[model samples]
Target: MITFWMQMRRTIRLLWSLFKDAETRGIAGVTTVLLLSGTLFYAHVEHFTYLDALYFSFTTLTTIGYGDIYPVTAVGKIFTMAYSVIGLGVMGSFLAVVVKKISQFDRRR
Candidate 1:
């Protein structure tokens, strides 16, 4: 029973590590897509689609709110605030990791 438990623990740790790596990559990709889509949305602010609106929200929350597109409604403002609070931390952390990786790469060069 003890040996079985030890094996299970090792397996769990391996699974957790894999999950963490995947989560970090997922966050980074999501952040980049949101930024790109947001920029596109801003460029075509008027008569935008639902996809454009979502893109705008993500970009704005990430603190890259290009003045090219802005919310004109009170509800939109409230939503923006909420989105920013939730999305900023994830985006910021992902950005920090990216920068750190880049700097490390530069050091090796």
Candidate 2:
């Protein structure tokens, strides 16, 4: 448990450091916009609460698809497909930035 906590701390520190970088911040901002837009769309179109919409957006973007929640309407379904494609690309870029930052951190260490 102690080791897990230590690792969590280290990860948090690394993420904080990454956020300090301009490139990382830019990509992260774009990712945030994508997530928020998706959340709003889900909330308005699917009648999901804000929290549920945010949860669905994150899971969909990450390709987790837990199946606890899903779209029933045709418009929702179509929007989801398009959203997934765009979200995945944005997420990929965000992750790539993180990985690059991590590599730089490793090298500095």
Candidate 3:
């Protein structure tokens, strides 16, 4: 338990340092906007609760596609297709930035 907490603390510190970088902040901002837009769209269009919408958005963006919940309407389906493509790209970029930053941080340490 102590080891787990120490690892969590280290991860949080690393994330904070990563967010301080300009490139990471830019990608994070874009990713945040994408996630929020998807969450809001699903909530309004699918009549989902905010929590459900956010879950769907995160799962969709991460390409998890649990299929437990999905878009019912035609517009919702179309939006989801486009959203998946764009969100996946944004997520990929965000991950790449984080990985690069972590590697640099490790090297410095």
Candidate 4:
């Protein structure tokens, strides 16, 4: 539990820093939309709880894929496959911005 909060705090700080750039902010917005769409899709199609749907969406998009939750329905599986493909690109774009930020910060020191 403490680790989770610490991680969240780290994430918040990273995002706050990332949003200082317009291009990165745009990438973040698009990534957020993709994740939200996936979350809602799972909640509607698989009837998962909101938090579970959100968790599944995050892990799936990030490709961390814990395998703790999965879709059993054929349609749900198909959608997940499609979502993952698009999400990879979306997440890739966002991560690129983060990497760029890290590089810029490193160069300053």
TM-score of each: 0.48, 0.87, 0.88, 0.81
Write model 4 residue lDDT over 1-109, tens digit each, in one string: 9999988886776667777889898988898899889889999999999999999999999899999999989999999999999999988888888898877765765
Cand. 1 Cα-lDDT? 0.64
Candidate 3 vs 4: which has more TM-score: 3
Per-residue lDDT tens digits for candidate 2, residues 32-61, read 999999999999999999999999999999
* Local distance difference test, each candidate: 0.64, 0.93, 0.94, 0.89
* Top candidate by lDDT: 3
Task: Please identify model 4 stretches exceeding 4 Å from their true place.
Answer: 1-17
Model 1 ranges off by over 4 Å: 1-24, 29-48
User: Per-residue lDDT of 82-101 in model 1, one digit per residue for the tens?
Assistant: 65775788677776765665
- Which of the predicted structures, 2 or 4, would earn the higher lDDT when compared with the native? 2
lDDT by residue (3-76, candidate 3, tens digit) is: 99998998998989997899999998998899899999999999989999999999999999999999999999
Name the better of 1 and 3 by TM-score.
3
Clashes of each: 0, 0, 0, 0
Lowest summed-lDDT stretch of 10 residues in model 1?
38-47
Pairs that collide, model 2: none
The model with the greater lDDT, 2 or 3, is: 3
In model 2, which regions exceed 4 Å deviation? 1-12
How many clashing pairs in candidate 4? 0
Q: After superposition, how far is residue 70 of candidate 1 from its true place, in Å?
A: 3.2
